[model samples]
Target: MVASSLISTNFLFSSPLFPPRSPIRKLTIVSLHKIPTPSSSHVKPHKRSLLPCRPLCPPCLNKLLLTTRNPFSFALDSLLILCTSLALSLSLLVADVDSASAFVVTPQRKLQTDELATVRLFQENTPSVVYITNLAARQDAFTLDVFEVPQGSGSGFVWDKGGNIVTNYHVIRGASDLRVTLADQSTFDAKVVGFDQDKDVAVLHVDAPKDKLRPIPIGVSADLLVGQKVFAIGNPFGLDHTLTTGVISGLRREISSAATGRPIQDVIQTDAAINPGNSGGPLLDSAGSLIGINTAIYSPSGASSGVGFSIPVDTVNGIVDQLVKFGKVTRPILGIKFAPDQSVEQLGVSGVLVLDAPANGPAGKAGLLPTKRDSYGRLILGDIITSVNGKKVTNGSDLYRILDQCHVGDKVIVEVLRGDQKEKIPVVLEPKADES
Candidate 1:
């Protein structure tokens, strides 16, 4: 390789690039060489020789270039080539050695404080959590064979070793058949013992063996504080028992009942994930005790969006006790039908307008007036209840709320607006025949 400014190093030995052998050393200096073009007028007219200046006696990097026939230069180049080939072979071997054993696994370590506690909580409580499947009867399109198919799913907890279970009312709603599955994968047929649509609480009885029933520890939600840690366990999306952790985001939340469309007061609000199938699952506090029942979520897509409502355990205890003993919620009734809140509002009235007071009912026995039609085909307004006892009554909800706190046979003052005067009448509450 002979060129200007580069030592013609050995054209002395056969070149792997330039070829042939010459006694003299030769080398190329390609960086300094530029062919002159006639089209470029700025080009210098004087031309330099290809080998402008001598580089060195042996040439630049002679051993690496193998420009000389010296034994040392030849030997050095051969050794370098052998090392490169060996490195490439080793790289190929490593690329092909992708076996599972090559990936070293780190040894297991002890669980963290919070992690261990959570793990224990789930393990101890899982036996109490049960899966519920709401079944619907479906007829085969072609065969016309009728069979029961799963329509929906939710979660529940064991109420006692007597095979009694507690869940949300909406969970088993509209079911043609119901099934309850225990934590051990054992299933049992379930029957509805009692339910309260207004409070959205339902009690189911399963005949599983006593050994499979593990009653959950009950806790009061009345003393729960916001920002306290909470846990939710349920079979969301028909999956197995899953655990979600969050804090009590709010307290004393009021939400409407899904079945009765009535207001459930003092509800618990949490951010723990509550999805479609988590309706009847228990919401536990940090102590792994049941605090509330996960009910509804505030999401547009029917998925969890952080906002969830739970029926408070304090309220649930009373309802469950009544249901377990009587198989129904026994509450005193006024034995009268009243106008809707919207209708009373439309009449510019601020009280519940008595629609009907049956002659055999308590309201009629107390001398309460009822709306009627006259011979002239004209409507006559009756007594408009202004309050029950001393509490103000503005709507049907208010009246129901007040009466729910009262008992049967309890005498109370019922204020009414009859014509242009106000009168207070004493009425004894009576139990509804169905509830009785």
Candidate 2:
């Protein structure tokens, strides 16, 4: 190592071992010293550098030592700040994306002309719907005479200017009298003109003035599609003049009426809120035409469960036209009591089973055979009818509905199932008594 040169005693010396100064030189060194007195009350700036260290050292050397000792402190603080800023930025970006996705943005050009027409139709048809109240005469046993009591309330609409109001038969069930209240708060006493219990339909004649009757425009239900927009207007739970909107959830549903054992076929199902009092209300298409009658709701709580059922307008029109003209529903029927259409496994048979046939009925007169017992007294399943009028009968309801298209006296071709063979038989249909 090269020896560092030191200035001492006003002389340049290479090392301590190189030379020793005389006493006179040492006294000169003491006189050249500006070292502070140890007992000094104040520390002076001149004393700071004079004691031990070199005054010629660079300032960068001291800075390098400080950084080397606790290097992570400053770096750690900077890293934390940078990480915090990045987290905040990510959070803001996520929030923006979520807000953008929450809404469905539809352009006006996306809607078809037919959609607009449907919306206009619903707007126009909502007003013609009316609320119906059924008042029954409940006789007190002590009094022994009939008097009026509010039995239930439902919905209905004016059929025509002839003062006829049409509604579901179940609407006025067990009621001795009926009344109709129009949208204008006009109340009128209604008389039961005709009722078809099997179809769950009834018509009431309210002798209101001609102007009080605003008939709803009827619509054909054959063209309804699932997810089509529909509206319901009725007095739900006696809350008068309530309007509910929803999509046609389903179609061609078979619903049974409790008032009648027969099934109401081709039922329309919707998501609109149909409650207790909305039973007879009109379900309107987009053009405000009456497409269905809002009748039953699928709810465990007996309220609007968003799943509601309606009587299709096609069924209502056919029944109501007959009821108003004939004082009864003109429902056609196949003249045989076939087994209830169920799975073959459920019926314990490979074909449709004949449970009963009226002796004087069409099937009886056609020589269609009934089931008989064996010699050992074992029961044998009867001849199963599989079709009527050349239409294949899948079940009992199918047969009934197919027969409903025919008049009472019309002849129909019937198909029957025998042991290992299918046979066709001609039966002359007969008029049957009305089952009310």
Candidate 3:
């Protein structure tokens, strides 16, 4: 504010908040009321000329101004006015600075201990994860020419220093060409090494240098406990290297393979997000070890709905080992076609009904009878398999699961219910055919 407005509000030479440093001389004048002059007597008695609340007449104000005017008091008023103005301006400046500080952006803050660990896990594992592209040849309708087009894409991880990558079988099911892209944006042509459709596991080989391959650390899934923390890294929706974390919600879960429609047992179920492009990605434990491979999700809209499943590393480790040694899984089979479980249940049969058995196969040669029809076209039921090596055979899945633990060329005793009498027959298991 200007010096004049401040001085007009309180004309005193000193203020309570901002007092003047120099001492001032006190001035006193005679009260007009005390004067018994001839002019004062002419004034009204109720209105004193010098009363503080009452206004003074022009003649009285002129007489008071002439008496109070002095060189010393005038200089003191000027100094007080200057000092009060500077103090008021400084107070306003300090308030403006404090108000402006609220708008300033804060600096970066330090990350928490757990947050730093998660960040480091992702960085260390990203090099092992890779992006896979499945391309198929298609003929154009108008141009009548054939060209390769991207069929689908998924994720994979390095398996060894030999450039072998592991992924789901359905990812490259009908693709005519495949490409693997590393984290460094380097792309390489990949060829199928081996695949097991029943387990939904496939291995691909890239001719890139061994230095580019960083195998994922393996962990045992057999000893895993529920509610354990896990991390999932994949290319969700084709976006590379997205990390998700959750706890193991379940164990020993079962899911059907998309390629072969067979039951994959001992699967891991987690709440981590796993979308379409996340197939074949690694599901790691808190220790940054591979415990499972994400395969499918339980969602109606085909997007992540928090419930997802992964093929256990114990099952995948065995299957991949067989695939690498042999061109396919080395699972042993009985070499016979049995009736479906639904059909057997309808027939009130508790065991597998042997519908057909080739005469040249092991089951036929071992005296296992196959169901047939007589000359009159009446159904003639054959022997029904009751057990294998002392283990009960309830359905096809149970039989396959038991056989998965057996080896080829191993002799096993097959118990069958022939008519009303039970008979035990010895049969040597054989390698399962790839086409079957």
- Judging by TM-score against the true structure, name the best candidate: 3
What local distance difference test score does each model get?
0.85, 0.75, 0.85
Number of backbone-clashing residue pairs for each candidate, in the order shown:
12, 8, 0
Per-residue lDDT of candidate 2, residues 1-436 (tens digit):
0111111312222222224454222111222334435576685545333213344234434433433446376456545555655565566667767877777575656668967765566456545778888898877899799789898898888889898998888888888878888878888888898998877889999888888787888899999999998988888879867777889999999878868667788999999888788888899877688899887878876656758999999999988998898888655554566565664448655445776777877777887877779999997877887787778766767766777678766778888887768888888766555533
Error of 1 at 340 (Å): 2.9
Measured against the true structure, the TM-scores of the candidates, in listed sequence, are: 0.72, 0.67, 0.74
* lDDT tens per residue, model 1, 127-213: 999999999999999999999998899999998899999999999999989999999999999999999988999999998889889
Candidate 2 colliding pairs: 121-286, 121-287, 121-288, 122-286, 122-288, 155-280, 169-200, 169-201
Model 2: residues with Cα > 4 Å off, grouped in runs: 1-127, 300-303, 342-344, 371-377
TM-score of 3: 0.74
Comparing candidate 2 with candidate 3, which one achieves the higher lDDT?
A: 3
lDDT of 3: 0.85
* Candidate 3, position 233, lDDT: 96
User: Lowest summed-lDDT stretch of 10 residues in model 2?
Assistant: 1-10
